[model samples]
Target: MGFGDRWRQWMMSCISIPKLSVLINGSPTAQFGMERGLRQGDLLSPFLFNIVTEGLSSLFQKASNLGILRGANCGNGVLISNLQFADDTMLFLEPRVEYLRNARRILRCFELAAGLKLNFLKSRVVKVGMKWSKSNVWADALLCKEGSLPIPYLGLQLGARSNMKTFWNPIRNSIKKRLAPWKSKFLNKGGRLILIKAVLASIPAYYLSVYKIPAGVANDLEKLQSADGKFSVGSFRIQLEDSISDFSVDHKLVWQDCCPPKVEIFNWQVLRGHVMVRQVLHRFGVVQWWEVSSCLTDSIKTWFQGWHGLCPSISHRRVWDTLFAAVIWSIWESRNQLIFNGEDPSLTQAANIVKFRTALWFKHHGRGSKIPISTMLLNLIESCRESPPKKKIQKEEELIPPFSLGLKFNIDSSARCSPGDVGIGGILRNLLGKILGMFSEHIGVYDSNTAEMTAIHRAVTMCAETPGLIGKDIDIVSNSKVTVSWVNANGVGSLKHSKIIYDIRSCLISLGNSRVIFNSRASNSFADCLAKKGSAMEGDFLSREFQ
Candidate 1:
């Protein structure tokens, strides 16, 4: 509202110069002056609309303050009068004739003052906690249609339980609508991955941001994105979780590299042991057992550590990580060439290809653009040494036990594959670090985020139910920043696991002095181990307490 004169002048200049045209029968009409209102798709339209709507919002506030209007009362004496998003508006008021009349008068006054007409015919008066006849009377007072609960607003159903699968139908339908066009087209694996990542994955983002998607709904969406109707065991979700489980300490290396996405994805597959190499092929019975080489195959973790050991300087580690990805990609490419094209694999050629690819990637994507590829390829180690060393002061963190009278609950989850087996684990302990109780259970099929949230929910519910832990200050710890942040923020930023978040909030409220906090994965090893066990177990929940 305190915009400078220059800002106002610029806005006016932009708004005043609207030489708009229309098309009729594929022919452009002559340009004409826009008499009033902003263009439909203009960037400034939302801002200007918000500014205009603020007047109506203020009017409602003033009316509520004057006791001429009554709004819905939230807990702790908080009252909500109206909510406006772009042109759509929701006014929450008591279902009374006087309030409706006052609202109608306010809308009429706003129409006259702002030169915007109220669309009463299109508007609906939704009544809550009022009889049908009485609600009809109130609607008649405002001269609008009467509406019921669970009405669609801003693409989400209002007044409906978020945990229900039906509440997520809109998101599922939206994704299907977008997928419908792409399904008819024949696409390669890479093309399908790109389409899923860029298009289908984004369809429910808005809904996900607002409401926690149900597990069933998330699974359905994942299935739509998968190349086959069934979930892929080699999906990024499973690979990422698998990498974390296998490496435990160095899993971050896979994503910390600057390689192209396709290469990075390939590297992730390699790390997850999902890549169909000779060993995997033999294990799957695709290759004859006798054809398997006598040479022992090193674990992916062992190979990853070997690469880490090669870089002495921490400054050159990132370049080394990129080189690692390049080398792996190059070797895989050579193997493919030998298998598919009958080309003999050559070690020197693979090394050259790795250097060239690494140098090219660094030249384009990394900070070594000015450095020549020839120089890098000739002496890769020297090229890495040329980059200035960056000193980082990292603060080390560890697990902190709760107050002597309080209890700490560490939670973790393991999701094997997309819509695959999901396991949730939590360990409860006293301030003395003595184990109080612990739980591990396979909780059906769900994504990793949902599994993490379920772990938190299970922990909180268990704490609330424990008679010995009642009225004590509780600390809920998880390695998942998303789960911790969502729980702490009361699920304001995202609704990806809204049902579990809701349960968590309810449990916390009941506990009175409980909080959810995040810690490093290293500190949550017990829960992680328990979760992995649960994932491997068959439909069994393991809970135990130590004296």
Candidate 2:
């Protein structure tokens, strides 16, 4: 397959003279060298197999081109001879004795040249838009079995009517087959949901992508997914109703946008008083009353009563719910860790995790309270109390040049999105505001902070490298206050890009009299424009020196 000498050598090393031993009845067979084909499970096996089979596709094409084999005619003057995926080959040809003979000859030629045996017994000659009797005749001629319409191809029925419910039965059966083994195994709601997503959801995706599923079939699949969870909930509700004179709770409160589905399910179980806490286990005679004495002294309502005092503002309901979910989920996880792993539970550690988790969630998903995550972690209640910053009137800000006869680098960075394509640009100007040099370059994929710090680093490096600007006092201006603060503070408390920050600091120190400063975006418009231009460019570093 036109492999280079080095590649060929590497591939041969991987597959040459491999020893194999078979175990029969707990006795190992003698080791034997694999002399015929590539060993099974080798990394290069698939590629080598594809390379061998590729010759067969070419042979079929060659036969069709030479008019030795007649291929099926697609619309718009397109003719298809054969389709090959991995080792499975499907030939499309005009129903003629001559074409079949030519196809057989081509396959034999490929088998001889490639030294790969074709399993004719496992192969099938499927006839389309032709008589059913002719299929057996063709199969006999090819020394293979006959196949009818709607035959399985790549785990999908090729000729089946997709709209019919029968076509979807295979997918449903596959999902059930996968779920059958899982049903016998005891799994939590989280584990079941993961299995449903990872295994069951993927089963129908292949079919759904090729054919639009009928609404009835879709509903049936949904029923299958929720069948176990619904049954459990119904049985528990029935039992609770039998015991209690009045047992009715609105389940809608359990589900919140702030919480994950598993957490919501857990909350639902908790609200229904179905959680197997020590008290519930004691009531069921599973645990003694002595064991339950120190456990769950407060009722469920009292446990969640902290939410009311946490965030009194009605506008911060989402934030409140997020914190509430974080707290409850943390407690649940802590309890599980203590019970399952036998770890000594620390309430303070759990509370800290809950606080940090809530702050993180609010930073990403929650509306209002646009405070820093550190500030939120320090005091969540006060942070939530502070409303989102109101829109202020736009004011013009002027760019201040260097105080002394030194160079000022107005640097700015632009990103398509956070953790996306980033570009850094800087304009070097003297004290009189004359542009000496300017650069616009797409750095790489990074957040805006990294991009901003990179711009400063690049500017400082440029200043240090330039002949005339060497030893000159430099002022690096930027619009990102966070980036500026991090740089000035020597990247203290900056966890994500500490290396980049240190590199920037090193560059600044190398410049001897350089410092990074903060400015409004309005004042750094030229650098911003250049950064945006760099972001749109094809990743080429463009630096222009003005005389």
lDDT of 1: 0.78
RMSD of each candidate? 18.8, 21.2
lDDT of 2 by residue, 1-547 (tens): 4568998677666666678999999999999877667766877766876777777878887788899997898867999988878667788988887788778888788778977777889877775434468887788788889886679978899778788999999888887787776664533356557656566787888787889999999987876666553357655765676898864444444455555677777866776678989878988989777633346545676555555457567657666777777877788888888899998767788788988887876666554346888888887866755455577644432346664568778889998766667888888888777778899998878877788878887887777677676577888889889988888883363877687788878777777788888877767888888999888787566786744
lDDT by residue (tens digit), candidate 1, 1-547: 4568998888887777889889999999999876667788888876887878888999999999999998999868999989987678888987678988998999999999888898889877775433478878877897889897779876778877788888887777887777776665643345466756577777778877877877887887787676544446556666678676554435568776578989988888887778887778988989866644445345775778787888878768878898899988887878788889999867787778888888888778756877888888888866855455566643321245763358888889986655568788888888777788888998877877888888888888887887766678888888889777888883364655676777889899898788898888877888888999898777667985533
Q: Where in model 1 is the C-alpha error above 4 Å?
A: 1-47, 54-94, 187-193, 228-547
lDDT of each: 0.78, 0.76
> Model 1 Cα displacement at 488 (Å)?
26
The true-versus-predicted C-alpha distance at residue 219 of model 2, in Å, is: 1.5
**What stretches of model 2 exceed 4 Å from their correct place?**
1-51, 61-68, 71-92, 112-115, 180-197, 228-547
